[model samples]
Structure formats: structure tokens, C-alpha cells
Target: MTDDADSGADASATDGSGADADGDRLDVGFVPAEVPGAGLTGAVETSALLVEHLSRRHDLTVYVASQHAADDVDLPAEDRVEYVIHDDLPKLPHPITAKHRALREETDALESHDLVHSYSSVFVPVLADLSTPTISTLNSYVAVCPKGDMRYHGKRTCSGPGPAKCVACVGVTGARRRQGLENEARSAYSSLGKLPLVRDSMARRNGVDAYHALSPHLAEDYAALDFPAERTRVIPHFYDGGFRRDPRTTAGDPVTLLYVGGLREFKGVQVLVRGLAELRSRGVDARLRVAGAGPYGDRIKRLVGELGLADAVAWHGYVDHDDLPDLYAGADAFVYPGLIDEPFGRVLLEALAAGTPVVASDVGSTDYIVGDAGERFESGDERALADAVERLVADYEERAGAIPDQLARFEPETVLAQFDELYRDVATGRLRRESRPSSASSPTPSR
Candidate 1:
């Protein structure tokens, strides 16, 4: 809403309200849609990493809003950060609205902060309306797409949201097919969910004084959605420190391929299984290891059995975050065949960082993230996915060697610096919404 940063004034020259005149310590509030450990969703993971990074920086006092139980997420032990849990808060269908309402109730506590940063766009209005400046990060397509996946009729990637398309894609037809009890209650629940989503969607569309896009593609998408291009900054998500593991050599034989996320249909678990079957049919020595479970877990397992992949696939449902590095390093390649427009593929970055090559679908931010470090196939193409894995199997050393350089871009400091500066800028009303990298051209993925 403010373009004061266009004057090139430094955030250091604060008015003593947020950061002190010395620009030493900054009191900030972090309001995530959901805290980590509520499931391994990307928002939760990013929040966890932010807490870890900000806590160690003594210059910042972090206040994290907890929608889940206090003990649910074992936050880092640091005096700089505190998890403010509101157990009695109503569990509204919309997380942004819920957190906003909860925080509004604690106006005194929220107002104490120098700046309030909300990862969910819907909460931006709540904070921006207050005296403190606000920064909202668009981690998903919720602000632009009603169903939030940016899928057209649940078949393929969509350009943007429209009422006619939405009627067929979301309201009536559904982006995903309902199964089991969903079949009986789909209509009723869909109606209930739509009401809150409409309200939340409207709130997200406006009042975003500052916005962070987790990927370049998402930033471009948001820009197309009428978000201020200059104010929309592209800051990719970062993993917590200690994600590095011992160097992993290529597997001698029976190469392992890993999938470490939700098992939902849009996640392309079914496509991954089909690709694995294709790999086996082609006589490639590959094993598929799936970690993390979701509502589609049973369906995925059944598909594995049906495809005669029961022996080839191991379902390690819901692996712990700490244990992920070992899995990433031990594998020869990580497979991501996501069909939906993912905002940012953190798992893909984890695979590259662990010195394991990746064979991912060329969709969403995968192109911007993996670059030439990992192999890519057309999204949802099982045959192409199978071929891509085989290519990695043949050129393992060449691809894995790029890990160090690829990993550097997302290193904590590199990514966190962008955030640190943004925090100060937003707090001091010095963030010009138009200061963004050119969107006219797509940057080539580095070698």
C-alpha cells in the first residue's frame, strides 16, 4: 500500500517504533497458517525453518502463533522466540481468518511487535489495518485460485481462476474425486467449505502491503493475478540447518528412488508408481521408497499392489524431518511427479542438497529450482519419468556433482538475508512493492 521504499531510504532509519534507532534488535510476529508438526506440509516446514533461523539471530524477537496444541510442535529452545498457543480458539475452516480472529483477541500482545509477518495472505488485512506494518507471503495459489491448486477441471495446469472455470473445476465437478465417506458427504461439506473460502479469498486479494513469493513461477503467477509486481518479491523457501549429510556415492546396483511427501492424487503418487512399474518393465534395477502418509495413502498402497509393485515399493509412512537426510542421501535419485502447480518443491531441493540426483516433473517451480542439476520429464508422464530416472542412473556422477552449487542458492544465509532485509523494510515502511527482478524473461537454470 506504501511505496516509500521507492525513494531508496534505508530501513535502518526507523522511527524508534519497530527497530530501535541503532537498528539492532527487531521484535517480529510470525503468523503461519499452521505450525510445523501438524503434518509435513510446506507451510509448516518453512515456518519451522524461519523459527530456527530467527531464534539464533538475537537481534530479532520472534512470536509464533500456534493453531495446534503447544506440544504438537517441538519448537527450538530459545529465549528469542515464543510459541503463542490459543487452545480455545475456534477451528475455522479458513486458517488465515482463524489466526486473524485469534490474534485480534490478543491485540495488546500483537501490537507489541515491531512488525508482523504472516505467511498466509488472508491474514495480511488483519495486520496491515493495525499500526504495525505487515508482510504476507503467498506460499500457495489460494489468493488466485479458489481450490488453491491451479488445476483446470483437475486434469491439467490452469492459467488463472475464473467463475465459469471454477464452477466446473471446483464447485460442482471437484478437483479431486471423492472416495469412501467423502462420497456421501461431499456435497454438504463442499458447500460448507466454500463459504469460508470465499471470505478468506477476498481478504487475501487485498490489503497485502508486502508479499513474498516462495518461487519465481509463483511470483509471476501472483503478478498475473494483479498483485503489485514491484511489491511481490521472489524469495524461495529455505530448509533448516543441519540438512547436510555425508557424501553419498552412487548406488552400485538396485538403485533407490525416493518420494517424500503427501500421497494424494494431485501429488502424483499414482504417477510415481506407474513410472516405477514402467522402469521395472524396462528392466531397470530400481526400488521405490515412499515416506509420508496422507488421506490417499490406502489408495496409493492399493495401486502399488495392483501394479505388482508391492515388492518394489516400501511405504515408510510419515517419516520424521530429521530422518529425511539419511533417506535423501541413501537414495540414488528422488522422484517427484506432482500434477498440481506446486508453489515450491522443497523435497526436490532436499534431494539435490543431499547429493542425490532428482528426476522431477517439469512443472511449477521445478524448472526454476532444479535447473540442470537434476533430470526433468514432462509432468505426469510416467514413461518420461521412468526414462528420466534411467538417464540419472546412467549419468549419476555428472548430475550429482552439481549438488554443491545448486544447494548454495537455498542455503540459510543466502535465503534468510533476503528475509531479514524484507523484515526491516516492511517494519519501517521502506519496502517498495515494485523492486522485483524482471518477469519478462525466464532465467536459465544453471549448470
Candidate 2:
């Protein structure tokens, strides 16, 4: 880390203007999937954490997709984190305009900021042009997976890198998405249906100074995307309510296996349900508490009813972020049986921070999130998932073993320090990225 004097000197060199005599100004934009103050979404959690943590040290400008007062969200007009909202965005069929708007905003912000940091891959296209340093934290598979689904054709895993099978698979959907885009100029109105979603993959590869992967293994996964390994940094997810240092150990029977994340198919909601049923048949006496709502909300409800798990499980449609603590406290074990590459499992961190033991499918950052503190199963394998959950629920040592020591590593001070390192690197052009250990599962091989 640069001392106050050296950091100030670097700032002076970058800002040429005379106003900053000491060069302490570190202008940074924390670009999120949406603005921090916006309504509840995964992006909001990350944005809030960053704003609350980074603002204590740097001048942060939070750039959002759009700032409109729908009946959904409210933003404070003034706060430590500044907001720049653009109302117009491209709809799903075409995101060209949206992409351009995002890029334009980054360019303008670069005039003031020393560097730009984003929490998602979608922001790369916008910030790539700036000579200002750039960094990103991959929250999901969107960086290498175009649909962000990690699942091809909705059922199987995607192969051969992003945009390769992505284009063909999208075309097979019969939306004629590619042709309309490729031949748009031929049409009188112009058909933009075929524009490549990964248009700036090359830029992200060459332009970004650093890309933060929350897990060590995931940093390697991006190699196929052409991102150099030297530029990839591994940092663990920063969970809320850290430093309290209470060891959360499950002491009672009827162990509750909880799953909290988007209630989508790829999240392995279906697999979880089946696994829970299998566990019950084996007499584990576990109750499942499934929270969060999404596109699969209705389908999940139907599956619960059909499987007759309505009595054994409590489905809290969508819990507010504030309610997360109580949910974590109430459960004996947290479970995530995702079928896709999850990139980094934030919920697993939240669970561990709550002192709740975790059991999740092994994919993406799942194992890294739990480390030795939790259990892992083969992705999409319901029987394997059931076995893992059963072990955690039935054994005391299994539930408490890693939960104590592993939980400490996620302390706010630790994570905030990591962010501090990234910030300093941007300000001084000296990024000494830590080769972080995998925090997801056990030291044991998952699978």
C-alpha cells in the first residue's frame, strides 16, 4: 500500500489541475448492475457493501443503469456515494443502446476518476476506452457466459467458451436474433438483432488492468476468455455483520437446510427439492426453508405442492435484505445445489458469517465459499446433494467443524483491506494482487 505522501504525489501527476495540492483525491466510480439505492436486487447488495465500505476512504461515484421513480425504488438525493442515473436503456431483444449508454457514462466519469471499478462484467464495455485504470469483481458467470445462465439450451452446461456456442444456441431459439443483427444494415430500419453480446470481450481482455475473481479457481476459469492469469486476482466475498465473532454452532435436531438465492431452475431449486425428499425418506428429519423469488417463482411453488413438501418446508416468497440475519440464524444448515457455474456464492458467505453451516453443489465458487467449513456435492446430482445434506444434518462434528475458524476469514476488516489494496493499485498503478486461498468448501476435493 502507498503511504499518504506517495499516493498524493501520484494523484497530482494524474490530475494535472492545481486544486489538489496534496493529490489526495482518489475519484472512483463503483459501477453496479443497477444504482445502489435502487430497489432490491443482487446488485443492490454488492453496491451497498461497496458504498458503505469504500466511501470511508475514497470519493465514490455510483453509476446506475437508469434513475426513474417507478413504484419500486427510492434513492436519497444526497449521500456520501454520488449517483449518476441515465433513464434510457435498451430492452432485451437489443442492448446496443444500453451498452453504448453505459460506455458513454464511463468515459465521462473517467475525466474525474483516477480509475473505474465495476461489480459486474456488463460494465466492462463502457469503461474499456478510458486510459484510467479498470478493475471488476465477477459476481456471476456473465463474464464468460453470454446468457449468464451457464446452462446451454436451458438444460445442459455451456461448452467451448462464451459467444462460440452462444451465437448458434441463440440462433436455434428461432428468434432469428443473429440474422436480424448481422443483416440489420440491409433492412430499411436496420436489423440489429444479430449484434454480438460479447462485443467487448477483446477489450475486456486487453483493456482491464485487473479482474477480481472471488475464488482462486474461478480466476483460472476466465483464462478461456483470453484474460491473462497474471492480471486475475482472487478475493473472497465481503459478508455483512462481520467482526462480531460469534461461533454459530447448530445444537438441535430437525436440522433446517436453508437455501437463499434466486429461485431459478439453474440454481438447482428442483434438485434441492428432490434431494430434500430423498433425505426425508432416509429419516434425516430436515426441514427446508427456501427463500427469494424470481422467474421460477411460480414453478417452485408448484413443485413444492406437487412433491408434498409444503408441510416439511417453509417458502418465504421473498425476504427483505434486512431479514437475512434472522433467516440465517434460524437455520442449522444453508444449502445451495446449483446446476450452473455460480462464479462466487455470496449467499454462502452470508450463511457462514451468520454462523450457519453450509452444504452446496460443487461448481464455480461453491467449494471456495464454504472451504472446510461446509460440505459439497456434485452439481446437478440430486442423490449426491441429498447425501451431503444428510451428513451435515445428522452429525454434530460435521456441522460445527469448519464453521468457527473459516468464518473469521470473512471479517469486514479483512475484506475492506482487500478493497483498499485494489483502490491503492488503481490510484498508483501498482496492483499487488494477493494469491488468495479458496474459501468455498473443504481442502478436500469436491466431487
Give the candidate number with the greatest TM-score.
1
lDDT of 1 by residue, 284-403 (tens): 878999998776788888888899888898878888877888888888888888887788988887777667778889888897788767799988789999989888777777777777
**lDDT, candidate 1, residue 33?**
62
- Screening candidate 1 with a backbone cut-off below 3 angstroms (N, C-alpha, C), the clashing residue pairs are 230-433, 230-434, 231-433, 231-434, 292-318
Task: Choose the strongest candidate by lDDT.
Answer: 1
Alpha carbon deviation, residue 2, candidate 2 (Å):
29
lDDT of 2: 0.65
Query: What are the per-model C-alpha RMSD values against the true structure?
Result: 9.3, 10.6
What candidate 1 gets wrong by more than 4 Å, as runs, is 1-22, 36-40, 58-67, 92-97, 159-168, 171-176, 183-206, 432-447
Off by over 4 Å in 2: 1-25, 67-78, 88-96, 102-106, 154-164, 171-195, 242-248, 431-447
Candidate 2 matches the true fold with a TM-score of 0.79
Writing each residue's lDDT as its tens digit, candidate 2 over 90-191 gives: 554455446445556445455467777887776655555555677877666655555565555555666544444665554443232222433323321212
